[model samples]
Target: MMTNSSKSTLSRGITALVFLALVFVPVIGSRAMVQDLFMVLTLLVLALNWNMLAGFAGLVSVGQQAFVGIGAYAMFGGVILWGWDPLPAILLGGVAAMFLSLPIAFFTFRLNGAYFAIGTWVSAEIVRLSVAQWKALGGGTGTSLPKGTTKDMFGVPQIKDLLGVSSSAAADALTYWLALGLAVVTLLAGYVFLRSRMGLGLQAIRDNVEAARSVGVDPLRLKALVFVLSAFGTGLCGALLFIQITRVSPDAAFSVVDWTAFVIFITVIGGIGTLPGPVVGVLVFYILQRVLADYGTVYLIVLGLIGIVIMLFARKGLWGMFTEKTGIELLPLRHKSLQRSER
Candidate 1:
C-alpha cells in the first residue's frame, strides 16, 4: 500500500530513531567508553550546525565563537558561582546562547556575502574582549568547576557498581553520552525541519533570496531562525567542552579557532549541505589526527593540503561526489518524492 515516496519517508524515520538510540546506548551500557564517544558526538553536532548555516542558509558566520564562549561561561557561572547543578547549568548555557544569537542575527542578517562574515567576526571579537575584561569570573585566568555527584541504576552507585567503571571514567563516559545524544538530536531536528515547509523556504531562500521573497518566503526570519538554531547547538557543545575541561578561561572559552577551524574543514570535506558530510569529515579527520599526532604543525599543514586537494578536485566535496556517483544519500535530509522513472 505504501508508495516509493512513503517508503523513503519511513526509511528516514527509522534511520533517525536508530541514530538517537546509538547516542544513548553508552549511558546504559558502560562509562569507560563515554568520553571519546561524547567528544566525537559534540564535534558532529558542531560540524552539522555550521553546515546548516553556511551550507543551507548561505550564511558563513566566522564569529560563532561568541555563542560558544557564552555557553561555556553560562555553565561555569552556574556551577561555580551560583552553586547550581551541572546538568541544569549546562542546559541553561545552551539556552542563553540561543537567546544571545537573536540580537546578532538581527544586526547581521542585513549584510550579504563577505560583509556578513566580517560583521560576525567583529561581533565575536567584541564578545571576546568584553568577557576577557570581566574579572568577576576570573577574567582571563578562567575558573574551575566543583565535583558533582553521580547516580546509578536501581539506586546503586553509578560509577562503582551500576556501570562497573571507575568514577572518573564513568563521569567522562556520561558526558560523552550526553554529547552523542545532543548530536543525534540536533541532526534529527535538522532532518525533520528540512523536510517540512520551513525547510523548503530555506532551500528556496538559499537558491535565490529575491525569488524566494517573491514567493512569500521571509528570508530575514528564516535566516534568524537558522542562526539561533546553529548557536543553540554550538552553545551546547561549548557547555560539554567546559564539563570535559572543568575549567573556563576567556581564552579557551572563546577560542575562535576551535569553533571555526575543524568545523569548516569537516563541513567542507564531508560535503556542504549534505547530512553525512560532517560525519565523514570527522572520521577522516580523526584518523588523520591520530596518525599525525606526533608531527604537530606538519599534521595541520597536511590537513590543509588535503582539504585543498578535495576542494580543488570536487568543488562539491567528498560526500557530494559520492552522492553524484552513486545517486544514494546515506543520511539524506531533503525529502524527495521518488520518481518511478528514476527508480
Candidate 2:
C-alpha cells in the first residue's frame, strides 16, 4: 500500500527528473527553442504571481501591468542612466515595483469586487500615462540598451568565451538560464507559502472574511503583504522579459492585454487556487499561440471560445480536472494525512 510518505517521495522523484530535463534543455536544444522556453517560463511566472494574488489572497487585480511597466522602465533607467549591470538592475526593478505597489494596493483595497478591479486598471493606466512623459528614456517612443551595455550583460562575456558561440547566442543562453531559475524559484516559493500558516490564514480569509477574522486571521495585513509580493514578482518577470528584448516602451511595457489579461485568462483556465494550474495553463496557452498565431483574429476568437468551454465545463482547470478524477497532487499543499489501516 502507498503511504503518504511514499507518495511524497514519488512526487519529489518525478519533480527532480523534470528539473534535470529543463536544466539541460538549453545544452541540447536549439537557441530558438531555448528562447521560446524562456518566453513560456516568463509567462508561467506571471500566471503564478497573478494566481497567488487573485486565487489565494482574493485580491482580483486586473491592472498588474502597472508593476510590469514600472519594473521594465526601472531596469532600463538603472542600466542606461546609472550604468548598473543588467542582471542587478532587474533586481532593482522588482524593488521599485514593490515600493510602488504599496500605494496602489492601499487605494484599490478600499473597494470590493468589480469596483476594486476597475480601480486597479485605472491606477495602471495612470502609471502608463505618467511614464510616457519621461523624455530621457525615449519618452513615448521608447528606447533600447546601448550595444556595449548588452554585450557585457552579466555573465554573457563568460558564456561567450566558454561556449564559443556568438555574443547574441551567448546572451540568449544566459537569459534562458535566468528565466529557468526565476520560474523554479517562483514555483517553489509559492508551494512553500501555500503550505505555511500564513497561507492557510489567507485561504480562510478568501473563503470567508468575517469567519477568518473571528478565527484570528489578520485579513488586512495578510492581503496587503500578498498584494505587494505579487507586484514584486511580476515586476521581476517584466524586467527580465525586457532585458531579453533589449528594449522598452511605455506602451509595450504597460500593456494590459499582454501582461494582465492573458495572464488572468491563463490562470483561470488552468485552475485557480492550485499550484500546478498555472504551469499547465501556460504550456497550453503557448501551444495554442504557436498553432493559431497565423490566424490573428480567428486565433483570438478560438482562444475565447476555448476559455469559455473550459470554464463552463471543467471549471477547475486541466490540473484540477486531473486531480478531481485521480486524486493526485504533484505538489500537495493541504495539511492532511493519510492514516494506515489497523491490522
Candidate 3:
C-alpha cells in the first residue's frame, strides 16, 4: 500500500507531466486537436470558477452568464468602437465584468437560497436586454470582428513567424496558449486560496452561516470576494472565447444554457466541492460530447441522465468517489494535524 506522502508525490508528478505535454501540443498537434483542447481548457476554467462559487462559497448563482456576456460585449466594444487591439480589449472585458458584478452582488446578496439563484438569473436577463440596445454592435443581431482584426492581434505575428504556420493557425495557437496559461493560473490560485485561513472561513460559512459568524468569520465579505473573483475569471474566459470566434451577439454571449447549465452539469458530475473535481468532470464531459454530439437532443438527454446518476450515486462527484475509495488525493484540502511524541 502506498503511503499518503508517496501518493501525493505520485499525483504531483503525473500532474506536472500532463501540464508539460499540454504546453507542447501547439507544436506537435493538429489544428483540430488544438481547437478541441482550447474548448476543453476554457470549459475547465468555467467549471473551476463555478465549483468555487456553489460548492465552496455557497453562492448558487445562476447568472454567471452575465459576466461572460458583459466581458464579450466589452471586448467587442473595445475593438470596434475604441479602436483598441484585441489583447488589451480582452483585459477591458474582464474589468467590465468585474465592475458589473458589484451591482449584481449588491442586489442579489439581499436574497437567500433559491431566491438568490432566481435573483441572479433575473440580473443576467436584464443585462442581456440592456446590451441588446447597443446599436453600434448590431444590437440584437450582434456583430463580427472587423476584417484582419484577429490577424493583427498582438502576438499573432510573432507566433506566426516562430511556428512557421499561417496567420490563422498562429492565431489559434496564441489563444490556445492563453487558455492554457489561464487554466493553470486559475487552478493554482484556487487551490492556494482554498487552503488559506479565509478559504476555511468560506467553507465554514457554507456549512453553517450562523455557526461561522459565532467564530468571527465574515460570511458576506468572503462570499462577495468569491463572487467578484469568479466574475473576473469568467469574464476573461468570455473575452478570450469571443476573440477566437470573432463574433458576438447578446443571445450567443449570454446564453444561460451554454454558460451556466452546462458548467453546473460538468461540476456536479465531476465532483462539486473537490478541487480536482472539475478537471475530472471536464474530461468526462469532453468524451461524452465527442460521442453524442451527432445525435441531436440525445446528447443533452444523455448528459442529463449522467448528471442524475452521479448525483444519486456519488454526491461528491466522481473525484470525490475515487478519493473515498482510494484514500488518495491529488489536491488535498484537509488540514493535517501535527503528531506529538512523548519524550
Candidate 4:
C-alpha cells in the first residue's frame, strides 16, 4: 500500500506531466484545439476562484457575473477608448473588478446565507444595467474591437514569425498561452493560500463563525479579502476571454447562466472545498458539453440532473468522494504529526 507521501509524490508527477503536455499544445495542436482548450482553461480559472470564495471563505455570492462584466468592459474601454493594448488592458480589468468588489463586499457582507446570495445577484443586475447605459460603448447594443486589433497585439507578431503560422493562429496561440499561465498561477496561489495561517482562519470561520470569532479570527476581513481577490481573478479571466473573441456586450458579459451558474455547477460537481475539485469538474463538464452539444436545452437539463444526483449521493463532490473511498489525497491540507525524533 502506498503511504500518504508516496501518493502525494505520484499525484504531483501526474499533474506535472499533464501541464507539460498542455504547455506545448499550441505548438503541435490545431487552431481549433487551442481554442477549445482556451475555453476549458478560462472556465477552470473561474471555478477555482469561485471555489475559494464559496467553498472556503463561506461567501456564497451569486453575483460574480458583475465582476466578469466589469472586467470585460474595462478591457474594452482600455483598448477602444484609451488606445491601450489588450494585454495591459487585462490588468486594468482586474483592478477595476477589485475596486467594484469593495462596494459589493460592503453591502453584501451585511447579509447572511440565502439573503447574501440574492443580494449579490441583485448587485450584478444593477451593474449590468448601468453598463448598458454607456453609449460610447454602443449602449445596450455593445461594441467590437477595431479590426486587426488582436493581430497587432504585442506578442502576436513574434509568435507568428517564430511559429511560421498565420497572424490569426498566432493570436490564438498567444491567448491560449496566457490563459494557461493564468490557470497555473491561480491554482498554485490557491493551494498556497489554503495551506497558510490565514487560510486556516478563513476555513475556521466557514466552519463556525462564532467559534472562529472566539479564537480571534477576523471573519469580515478575511471574507472581504477573498471576495476582492476572487473578483480580481474572475475579472482577469473575463478580460482574457473577451480579448480572444475581440468583442463585448453587456448581456453577453454579464450572463448569469454562462458566468455564474456554470461555474457553480463545476465547483459543486468537482468538490467545492477541495483544490483539485474544479479541475476534475471542468473535465467532466467539457465531456458533457461535447456529447450533448446537439441536444439544445436538453444539455442544460442533463447538467442539472447530474448536479442533483451528485449532491444527493456525494455532497463532497467527485474529488471528495474519490479521496474518501481511496484514502489518497493528491493535495492534502491537514498537517501531519511530527515524529518524536524530529520533535
| Sliding window of 10 residues with minimal summed lDDT for model 1 | 148-157
| Model 1 alpha-carbon miss at residue 228, Å | 0.9
lDDT of 4 by residue, 227-279 (tens): 99999999999999999988899999999999999999999999989999999
Decoy 2 TM-score against native = 0.95
lDDT (C-alpha) at residue 113 in model 4 = 88
Clashing pairs in 2: none
Deviation (Å) of 127 in candidate 3:
0.4
Question: Per-residue lDDT for 31-136 in model 2, tens only?
Answer: 9898999999999999999999988998899999999999999999999999999999999989999999988988998998899999999999999999999999
Between candidates 1 and 4, which one is better according to lDDT?
A: 4
lDDT of each: 0.79, 0.89, 0.93, 0.93
> Tens-digit lDDT track for model 1 on 1-343?
7655566577668777977677656556554346555666777888999999998989999998888899989988877778777778778889989998987887787788999999998888888888888786888787777654333211224545656756666667667667877877888888888878999999999888899999899988888889998898899888877878787888887777777777788888888788778888887877887798898877678878878998789866888897786565665665556764554
lDDT of 4 at 106: 90
Q: Give TM per candidate.
A: 0.88, 0.95, 0.97, 0.97
Selected candidate, larger TM-score, 1 vs 2: 2
Q: Which structure is stronger by lDDT: 2 or 3?
A: 3
Which residue window of length 10 is worst by lDDT in model 3? 334-343
Worst 10 residues of 4 by lDDT: 334-343
Which is the winner by TM-score between candidate 2 and candidate 3? 3
Global fold similarity of model 1 (TM-score)? 0.88
Rank by lDDT, highest first.
3, 4, 2, 1
